[model samples]
Target: MSRTKLHLLVPLAALGALVFASLSYAQATVGTFYQQETFTGIESEFVCQPSPIGVVTNTVTESGHFVITDQGVHIRGTAIQDYRIDFADGTYLLSVSPSHFERTATSSVEVFTEAQQDRGTLYSADGQVIGIVSVFTLTHITWRDSNGNGVPDPGEFTSEVSQFRVTCP
Candidate 1:
C-alpha cells in the first residue's frame, strides 16, 4: 500500500483498540469514565527507502473519556505520538503527532471523527537537523444501520468529510 494509506491505518488501529475496550461495557453502564494508555513498539512499515528502511521505534500516549447513556455511548480522546526511524548509517528521522478523536455509537447510528497534525524532522548522524515537514488531516464518517444488523453496508456508510494538507520546505 502507499505511504499515505498506511499512515491512515495507524490511527484506525488505535481506534480499534478503543472500540474493543468499550465492548466490556456493552451493558450500557450510565456514567462517564476516563482511560489513558501508552504504547511503544517497533513499526517497520513506517520506514521507507532513501531515508530509512529499518526499524522505526514508535511511542504513543493516549487519554480519553467516554460517556454511556441509556441510548448509546459517546467518546472523546487525544493522543500524542513520536516516531524514530533508524538507519544502518546511524542517521534517523523523527516524527511527532498530536491528534483528537470522537466516536458515538447507538442502535441506529454511529459516528467517528478525527483530526491530526504531524511534524517530521530529518536528523544527521550527529543530531543536526537536515530537513523538516508538516502535515494535517481531518476526517469524519457516519453510518446508519437501516437493517439493524450493526454493519455499515455500502449504502449505509457515508464519508461525510475529509481533508488533508501538507507543508514542507
Candidate 2:
C-alpha cells in the first residue's frame, strides 16, 4: 500500500507517518503517542443506480493513537464521518458513519483491519423521505515476509476478509 494514499483512506496516516519516521532509528524504545483532529472537505462517490454519482460535503472527526514497542508498531483509531450527498436530480442523502481501524506491524508481518457502518435517509427535492440507505464494509489484511527479507514481495500478502454491502430503496 502506498503511504501517500493513506490520507485518502483515513486522516491518521499524516501523524502516523511522522511517528514512523522517527521510530525507524529507535526500535529499542517503547512509547505511545496520540492525536485528534477534525476535517471537512468535498468529494465524489458512487451511490447507487438511481444516482450513481453524487457530490459529497463531508465532515470527519477522528482520533488515533500509536504505540512503538520493542516488538513492533501498533496503531488504532476511530472516526465518525458525516456526509451530505446531493445528486443532479436534487435528491440527497444524509449519512453518518462510524468506523474503527487498526494496524500492527512487526519485522516479519503486518496486519490491518477496518469496519464501518452507515445508515441514512434519502430525501427527494421536496424534502420528503424517499428511501433508506444502509452500507457496511469490513476489511482485513495480513502481509508476511515469507522470504524473511523484510520486503513485501508479491504473494506475501493476503486479504483475509473484504466485504461490502449496500441496501437502498
Candidate 3:
C-alpha cells in the first residue's frame, strides 16, 4: 500500500477503535430503571361518610403505567397507579395522607440460560419494591469468552434475555 494510503487508514482505524471503545464503555455503565411511573387519566371522585366532624379523610385511586428497562434483563408491560387521600377534617395528620401504596404484578421474560434460575426484583426510583420479573420461558442462551482464551472469564460473562411481558393487579 502507498504511504499516503497507509497514513489515511491509520487515522480511520484509530477513529473506529475509539468509537467502539466509547460504545462498549457506555453500555457497561448504562444502568436500568427499576420502576417507571406514568400518570393516567383522572380517577373517580369519592365522598367520605360520617364526615369525621373531628377528622375526615377521603381516599382516591388512579391508574398508570410502569416500564422497566435494563440492558440484559427482560421486562414485560406493566401498569401502576397513584393514590391520593384528602382530609376534610381540621386536623392535619400526616398518617392520614396516602403516602404508602403496594401492588403485586407478574411479568414473564425468556431466560437466556438455564443456569439462571431466579428473576431479579425491580425497584422504584425511590427505592420502593415494585414488582418481580420471572423467566419462566427461556428462549435462548448466549455465552461470551471475553479473554479469547477459550475459557470464560470470571465476572466477564453476560447473557441476553427477551420476550418479556408484564401483568399488573
Candidate 4:
C-alpha cells in the first residue's frame, strides 16, 4: 500500500483498538436498592445486581417502629441485604433480605448496558427489553419474582426495593 494510505490506516486502527478497550473497561457490575415496604410489622428486603455471575454475598438491616391505622397500616421494620459493585465498569450485584425473617427468600437479576447510540435498545436473552444502561450514567436494574404471589407481582417489585445510585470505585 502507499505510504499515505498506510499512515491513515495506522491511526484508524489505533482508534478502533482504543474504542474497544474503553468499552471493555467501561463494563461494570454493581448493585442498587430499588424499593422497600412493610406490612403487619414485617418488612421486606430490596436487592439488585448487574449480573449473576461471581457475586459476593451482602446483607443490610434497619430497625424502626410501625403504626397501624383504620384506613391503612404503617410498618417500620429493619432492612438488611448484601451487595457487590464493580466501579471500573459500572456493574453491581446485590442480595437483600430481612434480618428478622427465618426463611430465605428468592431474588432476581437484572443488567443495564450503555447504548451504542441514543436510539439503541437493550434486550434480554428471551428477547424481552430490560432497560438502557450507559457509560458514566446510572441504569435502572430489575429483578423477577419467582413466586406467584400477587402481592409482589412479577417483573419489578417496587414496594420492598429502594432506589440506589451507582458510584465509581
Give the Cα lDDT of each candidate. Answer: 0.65, 0.68, 0.28, 0.29
Query: After superposition on all CA atoms, what RMSD does each candidate show versus the true structure?
Result: 5.7, 4.6, 20.8, 25.8
In model 3, which regions exceed 4 Å deviation? 1-115, 138-169
Tens-place lDDT per residue, model 3, 68-99, is 22222222221222222222432121111111
lDDT of 4 by residue, 15-99 (tens): 3334444445454222121233222211122122244233233333333332222222122233343333222223432223232
Model 2 C-alpha lDDT per residue in residues 67-152, reported as the tens digit of each score: 76556767777667777878889988888887888888777888988888888888998999988888898889899988999777
* Runs off by more than 4 Å, candidate 1: 1-49
Top candidate on TM-score is 2
In candidate 2, how many Å is residue 60 off? 1.7
Structure candidate 2, residue pairs in collision: none
lDDT tens digits, residue span 20-127, model 1 = 566666654333333333434444543333543556666666666666655666777776677777766777778878888888877798898888898888677899
Compute the lDDT of residue 75 as modeled in candidate 1: 71
TM-score, predicted candidate 4 vs. hidden true structure: 0.23
Question: Residue 21, candidate 2: how far off, in angstroms?
Answer: 8.6
The parts of candidate 2 lying over 4 Å away from their true place are 1-45, 147-151
